[model samples]
Target chain A: MRFSVLGVGTSFVESAMAETHGFADCDMNSQLLSPRLRRRMSSATRLALTAGERACADANVDVSSVPSVFASIAGEIKVTDTLCRNIAGRDFPLSPTQFHNSVHNTAAGYWSMVTKNKHAAQALGAGENTWVMGLLESCCQLRSLTDKVLLICYEEAAPEPLVMGEQISDCAVAMLLGIPSDKKRSVCIYQQRVEHAGASTELWSPVSAALALAKAVRHPQNSSKLPISSTAHGWYAEVVHGE
Target chain B: MKQLSQSIPITAYSAVTACGLGNTPLYMALESGKNCLQPLELFHIDIPTCVGEVREVLPEISESLRRFDTRNARLALATLNCEKGSVRHAVMHAIEQYGADRIGVVIGTSTSGMYETELAYEYFRDKQHMPESFDFLNQHAWGATADYLKYELGLSGPAYAISTACSSSSKAIASAQRLIASGVCDAVLAGGVDSLCRLTLYGFSSLELLSEKPCTPLDKNRQGINLGEGGALLLLEKPDSQHADRPHLLGCGESSDAYHMTAPHPDGLGAQQAMHIALTQAGLSTKEIDYVNLHATGTVMNDASEMKAIKAIFQSGVKCSGTKGITGHTLGAAGAIESIISLLALECGMMPGTAGLTEADTAFQYDVMGASETTASVRTVMSNNFGFGGNNASLIFGQYADNG
Candidate 1:
């Protein structure tokens, strides 16, 4: 049984960067989100939520009924820093509110809470193929019960000094999937288990899989593609074949 | 989906914990009724404590996998000696042996690399400078663990990390089964690991959830839960003619009560839904269950809610116990660890006791096993794990043959 990719939305570095790539300009500074939610939300979450919402809209999905798989390479790195600071000092007093939001599942939790989705919801993260894994998980969820699964993948450029020369850019991408009813802009995903006998490098996060995916969605001519990312144990490579 | 009328098999497994470096030691400890819990000495905890810490400090990997500099990464790297390419090798071997391309990995963890993130904050603030050696790549979020694992294992099929508090790992297993049954994957790696961190300890302490002494689950004088660290992995594959000896996953059920954030529903509505889901998914009546691994965390609210949930579903006289008293609650890792205990009970025919269970609460009528082992003819076993925000999951495993 083959599943069809429905719609994809991505929020990347400012519009200036997109302009260079001949991509449509999406207002990065647009105030589409509530101030309070935006205030508390890390850039990763805000971008992720926005991208997911746009993709859901593109897929013509009722966000309330769909099961969502929100994937991130690092969830709320800022909160982790806050907690660490509190713990390292004398009289370590953790912020009860921040502590609750710090749960890696918080993004999905907020999605469910905000959308009032009683359906199954999950938050997933993998270092390398965050996008590929998110898609697989989404496909699996749809195969199990739901007809459609929303997969949101995102990563924020680590602040000031996060090694890797902090060259990592902030971006979020969301894709909605279902049995292909619409043919236009649709891509098919097939599962392959192969040994990754490739050169390894110091990559930032597996969310790069999402970047590769966005590229695929934008450029269908490159149907047969292979995107690989590193893990703590080895490497996971996603090979897309066929139109 | 309804419970599989046939059995599912566990073809391979890997584990890293204080109980031992691998699964054999863990099984032996459970069989001999050994408690891995000891005085806490791994990290800085002001309170007196008991923990299930790995006896040996795992060495650094010679050829490091990723540049994410975090304590959680260190722990993950330390635990990474599972025969290079064991995971992907197992998947390919399974495909060759069973003829299936659907394979996945479901991991669980509460705090991914928060320990390292925390350290980064201090370094940035104190010195007003970022360390040249500090690589913040993988330490930014909890998904890194799952991300790193997928890449490390070369699993491009399907993977996700479940972070439902203490039940995280257990939920991962449930998801893996669902994926397998739905044909999303032919096999899956399901388990969990959580390294101890000051953020977790201080957070729990602030909420008065950590026990000042060794945790005593189900005891009248029970205090609270002891935070722990570790990981466990179970390779799940669909049943085939050649793999007749594998244990079967019968059913899995999940629910959320929408109750208080840190506390459970007073009436156990979510817990009941989860238990009923498990039984219903398995297509078996409550009477068929041989034993229950309860989510008895020793917190007054948690214990009370679990008791209420259990009594609400099971008929009187069904035997159930919490193994947390022995291993302490490993938080997100608890579900995976307890799952091991449940399988061990089925395989070894010996039920590990509720080590710290003493005075039985008279409010509930179920049979609560005291601090001792029992050998019984077990056919089906159930394990429960609940997390913050009323997230709960229950899994049922049957004898290999009866599973089908």
Candidate 2:
């Protein structure tokens, strides 16, 4: 089964660095989100919900109606750092809210809470290949279980002073993937084995690969083969546009 | 889309926990009904809560894969190389049956290298930067454990990590089943690994969900959860002519509570939906399940909601119990560890009971086994794991006949 890109919600990605060989800026919509909940949200959760709301709105589907799959490289890196610092100090005064938000699915959980979406949701991490793996997972669900699935890939900026702080930046990309029904941009993905990951030297987040997919959705007339990001084990995705 | 009924056979499975190194130790502890939880020693905690530490000395990761070293990787490596484990043999066999490229790795973990990162942060406290030894990509990333498994096993087909809090591994198994069903992977090594770290211990403590002693999951006097560390792996493959006597993963149903960030729905509406969906997908009635391994964490709200959901579905009174009282709450690995327990119940025809449950909660009418049942004829089992995001997943397993 191929996925028809029903909607593409990508905002706040550094496309100059994320684009494959050639990618591109974001439009985040937050009017639907509650300000109280949004204020307390971690960066990852905020970005995911922003993109998720946009994707659902673009697809003309209620956010609560569809199951979601969230992908990330390092989820809530800042929150993790804060909690780590707290524990190392033996403060014993850690915030319960911070502890609850430390889960890798922080974004997925918050999205569910705000939208009241009880549909099955998943959060995943695959290092560099997180974007494609999320796609693989979403594809599996669309093929066997659900007709439509919301896939969101997000990453918060790495904690400062750490080496990763320089390599990683904030980015969130969401796609509403469904079975081929409309004339929307449809793509079929297959796995490929490699000696080294495609973007190994850059340590690219799934944001780049997802940004490339977002670019594809915008200009489907290009109809060129797109190479998604690769995993640490040299696993990558080869996306073929469905006519 | 109830394709979960396709029946994916578990070719082989193994688990390493505070109980011991392999399935034997886990089963023995269950049969002996020993409380494996002990005084917290892995890390210094001000609280008096107990912890389930893998007392066994873990093997060191190979030098080639040294960069991916962490307690979580150690836990996963212990399972991978356990002497009594069937994974080493089964994975090699799968490589021969299906090219190494056809077999996938789907591992679940909540905090993959968070403990190591915590230590690295301590280094940052003094050095201004993390130690030169700290490798973020290999050591601290959430997918590190899964990559370590893929590299160690030398198998590569769509590998990734699922980290949906407590339901991580069960969801990983469910995804593996779908991968095989989707024809992308012929066989998949699926399970989860989680190590006790200050993050979860202190994290749960901050929530006031940590019990000062051994946790009683379904008892009226139940306090809270005792953090634990361990991992379990089950190799699931498309059914073949062989291994029919083995237990097969029949169906998986997943849902979100959408009620709150940390608390479950008041009546466990999502939990009930997950159970109903799983039963419908498996094409079985509540009475068909021989037993249930609840996601009972020994917390007041969690236990009540889960029990209410259970009663709503299994009103006829199917056998049920919580095993976390023995192993403590393994967090991300809870799903896989408990799944192995359920599979063991089906294969060994023995039901492991709630270890810390001294007295059953008076509110719930269904009996939560307080002692292991040595004599039982079990044909099917249901395992439930609910996590922080209100993520609820239920898995059904049963024996499948082989074509000789």
Candidate 3:
């Protein structure tokens, strides 16, 4: 029911900025991916890797040694829309790169390829009670399977039809989680209630919920039943000092 | 294997595929050695190939759940409504046995309703906007179908979707197991629903991986894959003495090739690790495995890599076969459909054969079945599904026997 958060990393962009230049603000300067690799990826994936790499550095863990769970709401929607446009236009040849990168697990696959980690990586909706689901996913792996897991929640700024005709902040958050231990300084995350944010349009919202949890992990306070949601989606969790 | 996952009971299951509606037709086709794949008729394709299309006329989503109307959702409904509503009755029973709030739903899909979305995009290209009838959140968005199942079933527990391409549903099963294993939910409706779409067809075609003829896995003259579509659902519950007669999902293992975006590892190291982990979690050795549902997509590279992995895991005599010959490649739903096929094999004591295979590749250390149906006293079966992005998942199911 509880797991330790060893480190957290986040990347956030203003809604207005994300709307105008979703890719211009992308900071792909991380040391984990090469420049060639950076150019080949979508901005959403770059943000995910940037946050995941930073979380690994913050946790002082080798990225190659850990498994991961990459969550997203409208994963690869941009690329998918493009491919659909190509197909509708009667374009004969679909780009193989875009087709392969169009999967929801694109970020997870990229993370593993960069690190050469054979550890199991999972990709889920990563939304709808979005990051809470991500946290629960991490804790489940910790409880039943892996010792350490990298949990990354990221979403691209959805295009017009997919969103509510408004821009949401572009953000990606990553947390390194492990089984709670007295030997390590960590924050204990316990699920208070599972939420289904099914009907909410917050899929395009900023990663504010994930950011709140990361910020809570930083607070030197023992709080139970902390409310975190980007919208009216009801979900609650608690974080306590593990050290 | 750091830990042995509890063998969760599969209380109920149903599937809709090319053969027909429900597991009965699927099993009948497997038993009669029938190839259900036929020439594509659901949609037009420039490429000449056969696909395992669900020939049954799909039901319309009720006006109340019209927002969920899509080929994918309809396929799920067909499966749920199949066999005079066994899976539906099981869900209702589970809700009464355990609180509705204690049940969860997790479905997998490579594409929820990309077919509809692709049509919408065509309108947008011409009209500059989508039709008012299209609701991406309920129809085409990620996790939409899982959410549809949750709301349709009136359950309030955790629900989501896994979208790791081909391994989506198997991973969904693993997540369902985790929900039970982690004490989060008493039961979960876990499986996958994928419909044939132009994107996947064109995508794989552009890669030159589409076999013009029927896909013949493990055949010396194997070409490529014939894409298929279907939905399969399994009700996984916490271990119960009451349901001990049902088959148990022994264990699951997932790994990444970390080798290529689309291609698998040449030596099948990741595939081997996944099989090893699944067996370790099942607390069984290779000798105990009665059959393996190979993830052979009828591609030369895929079969070659998976064969190496098979060689590394099982000895020469272990029975194995690829069902893509009969069903074509179902993409996301392949995992759950094949798992159900394995469960059927255990129940009927009939091992499926390679439907379109003429000759098995002789370079392997394992036994790959041909057109001849092989029946044996099968106890435990393993199914493998490896997807793009190097995602690989293996699941083991065995007949529940307390004495063993």
Best by TM-score, which number? 2
iRMS per model, in Å, is: 3.0, 1.3, 1.4
Candidate 2 residues B187-218, lDDT tens each? Answer: 99999999988888888888999999888899
* lDDT of each residue in B30-56, candidate 1, tens digit only: 555566788777666676667767657
In model 1 chain B, the worst 10-residue window by lDDT is B78-87
Order of all candidates by lDDT, from best down to worst?
2, 3, 1
Off by over 4 Å in 3: A12-26, A164-167, A182-206, A221-225, A229-233, B372-376, B401-404
Please give the CA lDDT of all the candidate structures.
Answer: 0.68, 0.84, 0.83
Higher lDDT: candidate 1 or 2? 2
Residue B363 lDDT in model 1? 60
Every model's TM-score: 0.82, 0.95, 0.94
* DockQ score of each predicted structure, in the order shown: 0.33, 0.73, 0.65
**TM-score of candidate 3 to 2 decimals:** 0.94
Error of 1 at A202 (Å): 6.7
Where does the lowest 10-residue lDDT sum fall in candidate 3 chain B? B365-374
Off by over 4 Å in 2: A13-29, A161-168, A195-199, A231-243, B401-404
Which candidate number maximizes lDDT? Answer: 2
DockQ-better candidate, 1 vs 2: 2
